[model samples]
Target: MAEAAEATAKTMLGEISQGHLECPICFCRYKDPKILDCLHTFCLNCLDGMLSKQQPSTGKITCPVCRKETPVPDAGLPGLLDCFFLSSLVDEINQQERSLETQQQATTSPTCDACEEGLEVVSRCIDCEENLCQLCKAAHVRYKRTKTHRVTPVEHPEQKEVPSADLSKTYSPKCQKHSNQEMYFYCETCKMMTCGICATIDHRSAEHQLSEITDAVRSYREEVNDVLKKFQKSKEEFKANEAAVDHARNRLKIMVTRACSAIQAKEEEDIAQIKNKSRILRDKVTEIGKKRDDEFDKVHTDNKKKMERAEEIETAVTDLMQQADDFELLNLKPKVMHNLEFQKNLQFERVKHGESFIGFKCQDVVRDKDLGEILHEEKWKLQSEFGKKGDWDGEFNCAAGIACFSNGDIAVNDINKKRLSVFTSTGHYKSMFDLNAPYGITVTSHDLLLAHCEDHVKVFDKSHQLISKFNLPLTGTDSTDQCFISPWSNNKTYTSGITVDKTNQVALVDKKTGVTSLHSLDGSLIRVIPNTKMVPIDIITNKKRCILSAMYDESELRCVDVTGKVNVTARLGQARPAGVCCDDTGDIYVTVHGNGLDKGVGEVLHFDPQGVFIGCVARAMHWPFGITFSPSGELVVADYYSVKIFHRV
Candidate 1:
């Protein structure tokens, strides 16, 4: 008990302790490591890792060393979580080895590389003892049953893996928590085993099933030791690799010096030969060749001469000896050589890109700039914020104007049905809310959504949570009895518009006069933005910026910016443009009904900032009505009959 406590304390102190492990079974790290409830751990298969393959009963998993029977679990044994105890045990062994090494260092003769003392290599056994020369080895092997006896060659003390026998002397170990009770059997009923005395008194009538713990623990121990040993070896290597960069740098410099010396020597030799040829031709040009040929040869030869001279100077400056003092020496060498060759050749064409033996020139580089969103980041592919909708394979009746929530949910206004259903980004109908004649919808900073119904505007929080609704104040027009009444009256053609204000209040166009009425976020009607130019169709705001709806041609598609200034008025005309939206980059998109001009389905058009008519983005909508941009700016179109996402091409 004293020894166990001491071992535990020593192990606790040496978190960085080291040692190697070997499996008493297969001796490999070949199985998943696991620890049992017993704190005793091992490889799940290590027990079966030693099972006699052909025997059906090997599944019983008997211990290799003790032959105690261990019952396997019904679902098969579990793999290891890590052999914590084995690692601790290995650490104990390492500590002993370290102490042994310290002792050996003190005793060994410093001068003796081959022996502890200068005394003649003397061995009576001629086996493990030193100095057993060839003749002695023959005599040692001649003994019966001792042929090839373990003999140390007389040069050094034996270095071999020695299984620790001192483990009992120094390794004070702990019993596994579950096994501390001297596990004779495991009880299946109460999941607790009774001692031999208690087993008969309480569990004798088969209320419990029992398996021997000795075999199970032993088999597991072997597997645990194997994994711990492998991990320890890998950890040792990892620690040694801390100097990886320094090691790479030193190796690279050595290679560079060798390569440069070989290349420079070759270059110098070629230059010298060319110079000699050029001098010969210069001295006897008339006799050397035809005049034209002679002139060309002279030029080529002269250039080679110049290159050679430059190389000699370069070789002197970039000598390998300089590599030690200057880290940038390698970087400069390539540049110097390139400049010398460029000067010698006189033209880049003659400079060597390949086969001509010339060097390289590193031209300056410039990064390409992004044009804009429509041309740059195609968000549909990059963003995970939006995904497909459900029942997307068939036509989706999107009457309740569709708006995309920032969290990838969609609020579709089911106009005739008066049902505002919240669909998941995947088109899965999550929940629904009731609204009368809901038409247009937009999201807000407070997680609330602004929606337009018939005569009143409804506000909903992110999860279809109700905030409040606003009813239009009465304003008589046309005649006394025929004049539009409040909320639900004549001339009350609320064209589905909702806008937000500086105080985070929401506003909407009265749809009758194009007057912009602002309201508190809590749905209290504040007032109208008097003198609005056109009747409003839809409203959108993102707190920092706001968009007011108005007529652009026959379609209601004029976009307003943060300062209540008009930025872009869309230029798409088809059946009758109904809904419009602008991305962060101020590009406008509008949905229109089926046009007689194209004789096709309704379509969506895109326009650049300058109102330069970009082009039609998407087609084939039965009656594409309300359009909105996702937070990421992908075009979300609620086709009066179906909803689809389109990229601004």
Candidate 2:
């Protein structure tokens, strides 16, 4: 029991020494503790040291804890508000420590404050704040004034507990200016507790709103509770967000693992195919080598037989000349001469040039064919639609062409209305200007607008003012004839679709000759793409400088390089593909005028860079013609009567 009591005493002393009893700056017991406006308390000497380090001209000092600036009292550190509650707590802790030490040492008991003679304290009165012996305790209960006070036996000072009434009687801090009066009110303007005398004097101004301290505390508590409720809701939202992020992370991990497995499987399959091809090539090489060796062997055998025949004939002719008579030599001479003549006329075949060399030609990995492509299989939904078939400012009679500015503004050209209308990205009407037979439109890198009108292309500035106009050269004719008769069927030459390449070269499609030609900004012919098989309706350019033409006659989307090399030619069945455009990711979008029973209702189809069909983006459109992507990557399609916008979800 004694050991437990000592331990308890040590714990209480330790808590007091480390907690509110200690000064934050001094890291020791607080001496003359002063509270700042920020509600942080520190030793008076520590505050004085902090103040002395600052410039004397500055009347405010920053808090050492929260860095909030507090005005210095007029009389300096001594004029700061004293913390009377903390002072009393420090004294109570000190007294408890001494009492515990005396109990541990088994010293004499404490004397009673109410006894005249020196008498040991038997009990303590909570409300009267006095210690009493047995005799004084009896008298304290018997008196009328002190009889209502609650008293408890003081057998162990360490284990003493104060009554609730005693706790309510704890000291209220006095005002800094009026030291004799306790602070009773709070000045809302100054945000400070003030004594009654100080409230009537310093805080009596109209700007200062004074409230009783108890009322102020109650109101502030409610306000803090409301804020705390909001904070709790925010905390729950953060937790929900965290959980969603964790789920996404897990899903990403699963996708990565599946992708890795697929890549490994492809790698194994490709390696096996390569090995099989290598075996076949090696076998072919061996067969060719053996055939060449056999041909060389046959030539060697024929040459060796001729040499042996000549040697034998030489021996026979020599023997007949030495040993036989002249008749025998004469008889063999004709045969020997015949044999020598035959040998002299004979010639050996030589190996052909380059026959010994065997070469392996390797195709380019990136350019010859795509090893793989990073495809964005994004799905789009119709977000909004604007404009209608009317003569209004925001309406279009025949929305033939569409273009997007770098600032997300959309420009639509109406062929029937003969006007170019501009709208915000959200499809709100901005302005319109008069134009003639505008079919296709595009915006240049410098934000200049180019519109294909009849046989000429009109260039407009950012303000929709005509800057210049250039006549498109007639097909098969060098002259820039604005009105040239088509040589094919005597039809007038018409320019339908137009697009600008990366090098600022314009590609204009002529429906009469079924040929798309590239031209400079000044309308000088660069070259013609040899695509005369199908009538080209619309054209666009990708990042690779390849022109994508929508062939309405052939129902196909054709992609060709600037040099007329065909890259991809995708057949769209019966749908007459038109209004071709590419996104920032190089994915192709073609608006098709539906065929068969679905005539008049058009659909927008998406494709990869290589012209592989991805999916249908938008369907059931009323003759969609021109297509373009907004600056924010939204799809803007110019239908016959309205402009439709689609966003990737």
Most accurate candidate by lDDT: 2
State each model's CA lDDT, in order: 0.47, 0.68
What lDDT score is found at residue 381 in candidate 2?
82
Candidate 1, superposed: residue stretches over 4 Å from native: 1-400, 473-494, 501-503, 525-527, 541-546, 550-553, 559-575, 594-600, 647-649
Encode model 2's per-residue lDDT on 1-649: one tens digit a residue. 7668667877977786786589989898888988675556799999999999999879988888767677888899888766665666677677677766666656447888997888999999999889999999999999999899999999844543322112123445567788898778877677677788888889898999998877765565454345445444544444433333333233233333333343344334554444444444445544554454455455455555544444444443444334332222222333334433433344444322123223232332332342232211245789999988789889876786889998899998887777889999999999998877444788887778888876788988999898888886766532333322322234422224789966789987664455577888877899887744334667889978888888776788888886778888899988887688986556689998876535357999977666767678988898787888887667899887899999754
RMSD of each: 34.3, 40.6
lDDT for position 49 in model 1: 53
lDDT, residue 244, candidate 2: 31
Candidate 1 lDDT, 1-649, residue by residue in tens = 5346446545743543322255545554324444332222345566555544636755565545434345555666553234443444465556665655554554443231234445443343445444544455566678776666675543445433324423323222222543444435545455443456555666677657655544433433354345345434543433323222222233233323333343344334453434443333233322322332334344445545544444443443333222212212221223323333433333211211111111111222223321111111112221222222333322243452667776877777655445666766666667776666543666675657777664677677656766677776553232222211213233323255665543577666655545556667665666545445455445554323556353523554555553456655544444456676665544456666554434247777654433445556776655556777666445776655555666323
Give the lowest summed-lDDT range of ten residues in model 1: 351-360
Worst 10 residues of 2 by lDDT: 160-169
